[model samples]
Target: MSYKGPEPRRYPTAPWGAGDSATAVESGKLPAIRPIWDVHIRDTIVCLGGDGFYYMTGTTGDNCWAFNDGVELWRSRDLKTWGYLGLVWSIDRDGTWEKNWTARAGVPFRALWAPEIHFIGGNYYICHCISGVGIGVLRSTTQRPEGPYAHVLSDQPIKGGIDSTLFEDDDGKVYLSWGAGQRIREIKPDFSDFAGDWQDLAFDDSGIDPKAKKNGQPLRRVGFEGATFFKANGKYYAGACNKDEGRYSFWFASSDKLLGPYAGRHEGPPGGGGGNLFRDKAGRWWQTFFGNDDQMPFREKPGLIAVEFDAAGHVVASADQPFKPFA
Candidate 1:
């Protein structure tokens, strides 16, 4: 099947979808991330696949407020030009079980939301949130990035929460985290079920509530979500976003242990668009996010920014150009 959406942009240089044009037009040194045309709101998960290609995914459902479509799968090599792989999973895919719960809970009307894709155990596993109650898991047995991933959790194993994140530790243990001050769960080896009880995280909270309403107007939300946890410098850092409150900021908290006694901090400027902070194959770090909210018009464009560390160990994200000037 083929997708008819935003064709990658026609750069000043030449040719659309022609031979190696993306890599050939590289802006070397800095992390180069261009718009994944017609894509929006999907989680920005950038990881190098075991197959020697760089991969990423976005929630495609962001357009539903106006378009009514659901999630679609995507992959890229140079992080510039992206391919609309296929719709591996969606909320309205014929007889989706999520329809049952959404109809009952009154949230089914909401479009398909935040999704995450990861290359794990030589298999590609993806997770999607069911309104904010739980998450559905999907798996692809094949070796390709554009997966015909099967829903592993049609019944849905996540006990609760949305904007869920799937994380694998150094020991190969997988954990799921989401919502505000969410619990982290360890998944069984087979990815068939969640193991044991959920654990609470220790956060040195400084962010505001993203869902808070004021006297007459809704206050800008600053509460945390999109908790992308990863290991670096031999420690675990929970990289997450704080939306609205003033502007979008990517905040992080670090700890020696996987579950933490942590202090959270936010990156400024190209702040605003909440995203995932991940490392590429060459050891360089980058943060990828979409332009959202009144940040519409910019809805279909996703931006990538370079992240660097200071001598003091602070992660300073470069949000200068190409990236919408938010703050």
Candidate 2:
């Protein structure tokens, strides 16, 4: 396949307005909410449609009741404003499938995390966590933004058992990457089974206690699960949760090819980009991911932050905050 140059689209405007004239968290429009609490946003993408518009969705909290803790964060186009769209899977509180399995009499469905939706092969596929059931997919028949999506595949867990993300490479190949245990594998054309075999893409080698150890825990260093892949300037970039603690940071790697030999600086080991994205829109780069801790305390609302990135894709997080919308 011939390269198509940066995927033909750009992200929504940065939280603050554009250019060098605005201030961080511009005092006009209401702040964009994370929708799920506790669950720090791992990856984000602009969902595009054939009709010339885009939508938004990400794995946050459970659709039931968790801060930013939703199955999918629903956006109403205008990016700044959003609403809840329930769970992508059909397992409601009292559905046939729910009654037969997870909700049988009293059994409950547990954590659902890192749900990423993408449009592929003329259909939409939602890759998410169904607690103990492993990485799952929900397909939408029509090109509609909202879906009463149903599970198409649930064979096995993707290693870490959650934070599953689906990436379709430029070569018409699809791959699934997830956490709890970091893994990556090519998926069949149907987005069902593994295309070839599953492979480990990240990890924490030291086996030390991930929680108690300070900043040097190797066990916590590379255990990232929320994998998001994007191509730009002849490179494939995969960004994911850096570690389970210490400010919910993220790490990124670049490869000349889609899947292997990814090389870059590791976050915990030394120097590296700490958060997500290095750009926003209109050639303006905004580093973003998780801001604060958007939970019970409104002040602790872990919003999204966007900063500027240098030509080498390095973020200067310590620089003066930009006068952007989501400051």
Best by TM-score: 1
TM-score of each: 0.73, 0.61
CA lDDT of each prediction against the hidden true structure: 0.57, 0.46
Best by lDDT: 1
TM-score of candidate 1 versus the correct structure, residues matched by position: 0.73
Q: Compared with the true structure, what per-residue lDDT tens digits does model 1 show for residues 1-327?
A: 122233322212211222222221132322334455545444556667787677666555423432224446666777666776667655556325555433323322344456677888888877666563566677775756666666664455445666777888988998877765346888888877778678977655444243333554432222467667777787777766665434345566667787775554544324324456777777777777554432222333566777766654557655444433334
Could you give candidate 2's per-residue lDDT for residues 151-244 as a string of tens digits?
Answer: 5655334443666667777788877766632456787887566668777554323433445356754442233455566666677766665533
Error of 2 at 91 (Å): 2.1
Score residue 215 of candidate 1 by CA lDDT. Answer: 52
